[model samples]
Target: MLCVLSLAPFSSPSQSRSRSRSQSRSPFLPNVRCLFGNGKQLQEKRRRHSKADAISTQEVLDLFDQLSTAQNPPPSIYQFNQLFAALVRTRTATDNPVFSLFSRLIQAEGISPNDYTYKIMMDCCARTNQVGLLFGFLGRFLKEGCKTNVVVFSSILKSLCWENRIDEAAIIVLDKMPKMGYAPNVVSYNILIDALCRKGEIEKAMDFLHDMMSKGQEPDVVTYNILIRGLCHNGEIEKAMDYLHDMMSKGREPDVVTYNTLINGLCKNGQIDKAVDCLHDMISKGFEPNIVTYNTLTDGLCKNGEIEIAMDFLHNMVSKGHKPDVVTYNTLIGGLCKKGEIEKAVDFLHDMMSKGREPDVVTYNTLIDGLCKKGEIEKAVDFLHDMTSKGRKPDVVTYSTLIDGLCKKGETEKAVGFLDDMMFNGHKPDVVTYSTLIDGLCKKGETEKAVDFLRIMLGKGLTPNLVTYNSVIHGLSKLGHWKEAFNVFRELVERGFLADDYSYGAFLGSLCKQGQSKVVNKLLDLMIKRGLKPSIFSHTS
Candidate 1:
């Protein structure tokens, strides 16, 4: 039971009692009666949100200034609502500026906010994680009477669903509103279904679908799309496909979204052939595949290790008049790099530029990683310079890749230099970066320096994972620091780090070199006691 205004009621005790008296006089249930509006009408109204859609934050501020200084007639509440909606929807919008603008609007003479105004404010509260203040706005929205705009109540349902208050939203908005002669419509049902699906409540969402149909509210393409997407997301692809059949039997034609969702799901499940067949099926059904459709397929092909096939598919996509975007290029480059085809990946990068498609940070990072893995560190640095020259910033991944290459080549000091340069460039080293450096230092017999770095990482509040702990145990064991190595191993275990085969092997192999045969055998017995089978590497060690 999620509370809409569980934080605290906003109205005064006397005002609440007065409202209670007013509600009791009416024939409706005061406890459950809420504002409900026609969702179809709300959709129609939003379709006309062109002016609000194009309006920016600065333009909204300018409108406010104009409103404040206007001489005779003040601006209409409709105009005020449009500007308010634009401000609330701004991506970079902060709480204070929005509230300040809203506060000034309500205070202005002759400006009375409508359902649209309350809806925008409610959305703002939800977006800013200020749900506690939600009651104040909702109270005002519904204060008009029990029979206000359904759209505002729809906003309440959306807000509640967004907050994962599904049960309360369903009962209060879905079940109760209908008893007051305002049954939830298809749009209302879709909102609840989408919410439930997002929470992985597929069974409950399906129940809502059945209930919606039992009420004779026909499910639209959007409704089925949501169900299909949810089923696919939950790994119930077969069930999702069954819904597609059910939808067609009900005469609702499957749209591009339906096909795309199934294709993506099939690809992820390693059913590439089926994904391609689905694409063909989509084309046969007279639906043109969009850029998203192609990109998803190309990515699928790449992940399946069919790099050449993916490249060919991308070329086909381009020939079909759908230009390859940066994502398509990046995906191909990453696949080629993973397959050790660095030259081909570099060629694609050049080709991408020739086609006026700018390579992003991902493109450069993938290529740099490929070069480093091939021991072409010098070439990798050149590409790094090239990346910076093009005004693209090298992130932690860029620096980390270079550091790893340097460490592998036994250039520990140079790797440390790159770490400094990484910080100087305003990029903080993540745990992976620190771990790479520590591993390199330990491998070079710099035990004291490696320990210092471990302390620095911990001081920075970065928890060292299993890889980090494993590196320390291996290094300390190699240096014949038996006590410290065992202590570190114990610490790793107590920290809930489960040792894998490499964990045991690395430590045993290191000690084996020091002729600790007896110790190694005893350790093997302990490993078996802990339900860990010794790998051949451990037995050989």
Candidate 2:
């Protein structure tokens, strides 16, 4: 739903025609005057009349009827209603009523659909993923002599590509444009190129770039940047670099997007040195690296285990008048955590707060995971408390990590207590939470409590995932309760679970430990029948 509009306005012929008509009529009348003379007295009468005036719905309807009766009529009052419906549909969702209302207005009042009408409906359809309806309406518009311009095509092009209709997008771009008497603008080319790149059609994207020039249409900076970004996105770093070089050779300066695109790709592909070189390349070209550019490079360095250099780049970003946002802090924290720098990660969290940048859920989640991993479960718990005090409630992730941490530390009772508190706080325990707690309980010989929580999770309408089944099965089997474990296994198979590697492995191990060789052989046969091979450990045990 995020849209970026190119700022340069296109002046339509209709506006010019209106202006010409007004100018050809006459200039303002030199001696024009009100019949009621003295302007102050007339203004007073008008104010009194305006204050006393009110119009009934019936009166409004009558006026609309009168207006519609004329040939070449002005729009009726229902025009506003149709517009309102479209606006409402855009916000909430597009339903039948809004479309039905517009169709009715078009039929009943003879109100020809205008550009705004089509644009609004297309936007609604795009938002709701109703591309078929959008295409149908576009066909209607074409039949009605309304041309599909750049904006109209751009809106639906993304939808088509998103829905994996790349063929349709190509047809619209290459075949349909000339047939419809509309030339593809820069925006049109950008859409097609972006779509092709997203679909991994890098060669086709290049072909479109060539086709644009062959058709005598000039490609702008936006067009090249789209292709560059698309190539980079698909990890076609070499191809993206070629396009970047081609753009530079033409004296078309690569903007922030171009540099950022290449830098992000390089960093992501483990070419952090090259990405940094690209950043310096931008500076050489007299183009300043924006915060996004620096963030991408820093994140890449951090991912590459160059944590100190990444921090230095972050400091350089701050010195260059770029304030690090959440993404900046997240990259740093994530990198520090990766290197087992838990204290520094926590310090960064404190720094984020001291600088008035409140840590979002991701920030808290990262810190929580790091702290938990470092066996600082108490600090992680306290972090959650601090989050709540700062009015940022713990999300499912925060609770899940803490619960998992507690479970690992043999604090099953505290983990269960936390789950209860989470439920009371309106954060439902997902399957992962249940699985973690169940695994912890099963290991601690608390099979009955694990079973109880599993039942409650099911009662809450959450189906037990593979991990939940594995935990409970392993728990029951460990307690010499083979019947309950087998029952769970049966229930899982009945629900059409894949009886995946972990589940089969855990079951076979339990059966072996219990000396139930008969059940173990039968389960292995069933696993093979289901085309699931048991793990080596499962077989050897």
| Predicted candidate 1 versus true structure: per-residue lDDT over 296-389, tens digit per residue | 9889999999987787788788788999899999999999998999999999999999989998899999999999999999999999999999
Q: Candidate 2: misplaced stretches above 4 Å?
A: 1-151, 155-165, 201-207, 500-502, 526-536, 539-541
By lDDT, who's the top model here? 1
Worst 10 residues of 2 by lDDT: 26-35
Residue 486 CA error for candidate 2 (Å)? 2.0
lDDT score for candidate 1 against the true structure: 0.78
Pairs with backbone N, CA or C atoms under 3 Å apart (clashes), candidate 2: none
- The lDDT of each candidate is 0.78, 0.75
The estimated TM-scores of all candidates read: 0.83, 0.74
How good is model 2 by TM-score? 0.74
Model 2, 205-297: lDDT tens digits are 888889888988777889888888888788889988998888878888889888898999999899988998898989998888888998898
